[model samples]
Target: MSTPHVVVVMGVAGTGKTTIGPLLAARLGVPYAEGDDFHPPANIAKMSAGTPLDDSDRWPWLDAIGGWAHGRAGLGGVVSSSALKRSYRDRLRAAAPDVVFVHLSGDRALIEDRMAHRQGHFMPTALLDSQFATLQPLEADEAGVAVGVDGTPEEIAERAVEALAALPEPAL
Candidate 1:
């Protein structure tokens, strides 16, 4: 079988990273990972208590996820990460140089509505503003695509797959 693309489905809280990640992985015939699962308990607690995590708290978590991405680099998989800042993405890229990102973007109102309706998530709605403030959209040189979250998860995943396919293959 051909190696699958290792994709990081990224965005702020409630942009549907968790929801869309599995769909994208399944559509691409790859394994799926939830980035939140890599978080340290302390970090989860902080977010659950409606506090935004500091850089120190996030670095280890990002490194863990990046390490996971490194493990799956050639094997292919889909994982979700907030990846709210350029520096965070760079850290992940450092671990998995070939990884691609799929940024889920949408209007603030829509994201807030989703977060409000979300259940069983550690991230609280009160931290949504902080998340947006920290989010830095993918730059032009980045190996990724920004898919708007205006459609069903399936539609969004479809668009992601198409976008990934359209990208030129990495030079050896």
Candidate 2:
């Protein structure tokens, strides 16, 4: 459990990865990248049209993101993504063993609320349920912590920082 140099705030859509990632990055004093920005045009279009992406649609994008992760977090960087499946996390881990996932767990109501209230996002509110259905909560076997979203964004970010701080430092 080395302190994660490259940390990913991961979960299904509306789990606050975008909102909390930057805060976590600030806490860790590392630069951050939003996983959505890495999505290829087709994936973005599908999601914008309220279609949930399948594995085939995701693999290439995931690979590209992994390559980016390899370079930035090879040294260490913070990233935010809806890393909903074990395979997705594996792609990231393949890039860097030091990569750690921060799983944000919240109930459907709260997540839907966030998605509905979210503004200026390509992902549509209609896709929320599908995202939840597709989400495979990170297993304990995965190397990281599962954080409960039971408080303010500040509280969650601070809790994540504290947990990360307690882990052993990266081997780098």
TM-scores of the candidates are 0.96, 0.91
Worst lDDT 10-window in candidate 1: 163-172
Question: What TM-score does prediction 2 earn?
Answer: 0.91
Identify the runs in model 1 with alpha carbons over 4 angstroms from their true place: 1-3
| lDDT tens per residue, model 2, 23-69 | 99888777888889889999999888888899999898778778877
Q: In the order shown, what is each candidate's alpha-carbon RMSD? A: 1.7, 2.2
User: What total of clashing residue pairs does each candidate reach?
Assistant: 0, 1
| Model 2 ranges with Cα > 4 A deviation | 1-4, 168-172
Deviation from native of the Cα of residue 80 in model 2, angstroms:
1.0
What TM-score, to 2 decimals, does candidate 1 have? Answer: 0.96
Cα lDDT listed for each candidate: 0.90, 0.81
lDDT of 1 by residue, 49-121 (tens): 9899999999999999999999997789999999989999999999998888999999999999999998888
